[model samples]
Target: MTPNPTNAPARLGVQLQPQHANYTQIRDAVLRMEDLGVDVVFNWDHFFPLSGDREGLHFEAWTMLGAWAEQTERVEFGTLVNCNSYRNADLQADMARTLDHISAKGGDTGRFIFGTGSGWFERDYDEYGYEFGTVGSRLDDLAEALPRVKARWAKLNPAPTRGIPIMIGGKGEQKTLRLVAEHADIWHSFVAPGDLQHKLDVLARWGEKVGRDVSGITISNELSRGSLDDGHADALYAAGVRLFTLGLSGPHYDDTPVRHWLAWRDRKNREAGVGAAA
Candidate 1:
């Protein structure tokens, strides 16, 4: 884990929920987001939409990531949180490496973030022929898979275009935090600002036990799902969050919400004396 100090530069990420929109609409949205200067763009790893119609129009995550690699120029793109249950760890490593190369503008410098999590949505498993294990077992699987992922990256032919940042999402104090302390370059969680301090405290303990300085791990928080304005981003920053993400659902993905968050992000970045483009 790359232990970044608590004062890491503020950044913004946008998650493009792959549901209800056709490929053209999704593609256009992604391009528009890049133009708006989000530091990262993401899509989730799931076979179906998480809300509003379980059987809604949805696209696979990694394949679309591959598309994002070809589509955008500057913004880093990735899975908001890939479920590790679907494929072998080594294969994922190879895919990440490939995407890294594809996103690289100058020969080999990819902008791919490997954000992943243990499988949670059970329907993705039942329908896809994966063994739907209990939560603990799934976490165990994630813990086991990540090292293999790194190892595979090391052994890949051309290697990744650059060091891929591993962003692990979850707030499980016992296993997830420990994994973040051990493996994550970015720690993503849904904990609101009021609850963030305690999670950070736990993460620090995990860091101490793991003998890793998690201060370098970039903190990521999600924007409130229902609102358009900034809710706790500033508070989260005060509590050490540097990456604020907002996810948009589709069919008709209004750019209004994203633009609002972008405005908030710009203000925060200006205050921090950092360019929002990075």
Candidate 2:
């Protein structure tokens, strides 16, 4: 397995779930999160609320992303994991490239991150008229689609301002890890601290099979389910997670939990001899 870089500073992220709130509230939350000094901001790709009211106020991911590209001055942004089944691969690439250009302030490269998955939400598929195929079939489709997305990026007119970072979210060892080895710049997973090392071991074998060194791929973990008091954050960091993300629901978009994680991140970075923003 690729060793966790002991010197690397931990980065904080938050997924502003686009449910249970209005557009203005979500917009305000975005601004607040960036102000709170997060390294990245994310949103989920679902048509309905995963919690609370089944028909709560919700917004689409890509369109809001266009707004986010133009709204935030800093902090990378993307979906926590876009459902690959929602759109055509080439169109997705073009949309990502467009956002990349839109996010490019001054002359810097775009900060858009293309975080995607094979999709599993049955309601989304059923309601939206997409095929909720078998998990293996969906994974197979994603494996095919990702390459097309990359190839399209290469052929786009102006091209992306930067090589848009590809973040694949899943813990499936065989197919998902292989795809991560083949394409991902970041791998987002929910593997528990105790299981992290084993997952990393599986990832490494996939990397070897693909003939790609996976050491450069950033390890991302979800911290939304638990508090930092449990020491899970520290354990994930110790294992290899450099990007720690939490999910914030709407209405008020509370920053209390965010501040706690931010403080933890600052402390961790300082201990590593890095600046808070680093």
lDDT for each candidate structure:
0.87, 0.91
lDDT of 1 at 202: 87
Kindly list the per-residue Cα lDDT of model 2 for residues 108-226, writing each as its tens digit.
Answer: 88999999999999999999999999999999999999999999999999999988999999999889989998999999999998999998898888888889988888999988474
Please give the distance, in angstroms, between residue 175's alpha carbon in candidate 2 and its true position after superposition.
Answer: 0.7
TM-score of candidate 1 relative to the true fold: 0.95
lDDT of 1 by residue, 107-209 (tens): 6488999999998998899999999989999999999999999999999999887779999999999999999999999999888788888888888889999
State the lDDT at 135 in candidate 2: 95
* Residue pairs in clash, model 1: 3-216, 4-215, 4-216, 4-217
Q: How high is the lDDT of residue 215 in model 2?
A: 84
lDDT assessment of candidate 1 = 0.87
